[model samples]
Target: MAYFSVRNITKRYAAHTALSNVSIDVPEQSIFGLLGPNGAGKTSLIRIINQITGPDEGEVYFGNEKLAPHHVDRIGYLPEERGLYKKMKVGEQALYLAQLKGVSKADAMKKLKYWFEKFEIQAWWNKKVEELSKGMQQKVQFIVTIIHEPSLLIFDEPFSGFDPINVNLLKDEILNLRKNGATIIFSTHNMASVEELCDNIALINNSHKILEGSVKEIKKRFKTNTYSIDFDGFTGPVNPLLPGGFVLTEDKSDDDLRQVTVTLPATATQNELLNAFMPYVNIHAFREIIPTMNEIFIKTVHAAGNHSINS
Candidate 1:
């Protein structure tokens, strides 16, 4: 059974619908990407899951049981909007937030110390939150969010405001968390991160889910059956060598070597494509071209005709 499931969830505020019949099943110990453009109801669904807001219709399930108020303690959320007590000392505030998540003060301090050392921010323990840079404050917020070791984590744009080095640091930590049996719902506009971290994803646009599946499956589902070939030596007109239902989309040459991209008919196989081009070109390398998450996201959203930002 899915560890967490959102079932036909719908939400509306006045006349504006934020989400409509949206659903996704997140498997345990997997990184699930929650994706969409701004104002696409990604935040709305997230808020519902965190119990910050209630769904007007439909239900949320955790471990096959219906979600309840008490489930809040089992989930960790790091919002895109950073929140900290600006006047409070970093360690003091972190301990307070951890306690709110049900961790005792003593334990929170111990965990905070470990995280601070790991992040090389031990010097900032007594510093006021306002004294830290945006990135530093973000690290503290992240530490507080996960200190309780919640079973399920929801991070919305967690990498925002960090430098590349810190981003990689956090990325590694996230992977480690998953390795240690944490189920994650990662929401972000960063397609490269989604490709690298997500096992599965669901894309919402205009308050509707336009796509959802394992990352590999979704890419394969939208594949165009295109293949790129690099070859040398023999060169001739591709039109005559082409079999029925094959078209060369690109052909470029450098000296004796030439590279070509071919689109195969839906009914055709790679072997058939290879055989058709064998006589005209000395094939050096061939690889199937897979669409990237960015391409798929734009294509699907455009196809849905919900291109304008709602907010």
Candidate 2:
């Protein structure tokens, strides 16, 4: 069952419709990706879910209970924009935020110290927020967001200011959070991260949900039935030997080994392709070419007839 689900939620601002009948289901203890181009209503829906704003229509439910103000305590949100008091010391600021989230002073300090040590930022504890770099401040903000240990986490571009090493570190922590029973709604423009961290995703464009499903299933659904094979012992052109309805899209040879990619007919099976090539070439490796999330995102958005989305 879905731990959190939005049903036909709509939001408007004056004459503009920020979201139109948008809905999504986030499974418990899983990372659910919320994806869309700018001005696509992703932020609007997030605000509604956080109770920062009310939807013009529809409902949001957490488990079987309809979303209410009391639900705010169970959620942690890290917005795309950073909001920190420049004059406050890092350690003090974190403690204050944690207390606001209902954590006891002693517990908050203990948790803060643990996270500071983990991120190797213990040395910066006494320094004011204004003295830190953008990435350092981002790290502190991230710590505050999760310090309360809320049941559901909403992270919008959480990796924005981090270097590659820190990005991977955050990814590991996010996966670990799920293992520890925390549900997450991740929103970002990084398609590569989506492929790595998201189990499922819902793509919103033009204020509408255009696609939603498991990452593996979506990639398989959009597959083009293309396969690449690397082999040896094939000296001559295999086009004449290949059965009808197979197109050799690419062929590369280096001395003894040759690699070729073939597009099979829609009705053809992997076994059929294997049987046809086995007689002529020694198959070393055979694998299907799956489209990446980046490729799929562009294709789906364009197909939805939004021409100015790239702008």
Superposed by TM-score, candidate 2 places the C-alpha of residue 120 at a distance from the truth, in angstroms, of: 0.6
List the global CA lDDT of all models: 0.93, 0.92
What TM value does model 2 have? 0.94
Q: Please give the clash total of every predicted structure, in order.
A: 0, 0
Instruction: Provide TM-scores for the models.
Output: 0.94, 0.94
- Position 213, candidate 1: lDDT: 97
**Once all C-alphas are superposed, what RMSD does model 2 give against the true structure?**
2.3
lDDT, model 2, position 166: 93
By lDDT, the best candidate is 1
Backbone clash pairs in model 1 (N, Cα, C under 3 Å; residues 3+ apart or in different chains), count: 0
Native-vs-model 2 lDDT?
Answer: 0.92
**What digit string (tens of lDDT, one per residue) describes model 2 on residues 4-112?**
9999998989978888888899999999999998998899999999999999999999999999989999999999999999999998899999999999999999999
Residue-level error in angstroms, candidate 2, position 189: 1.1
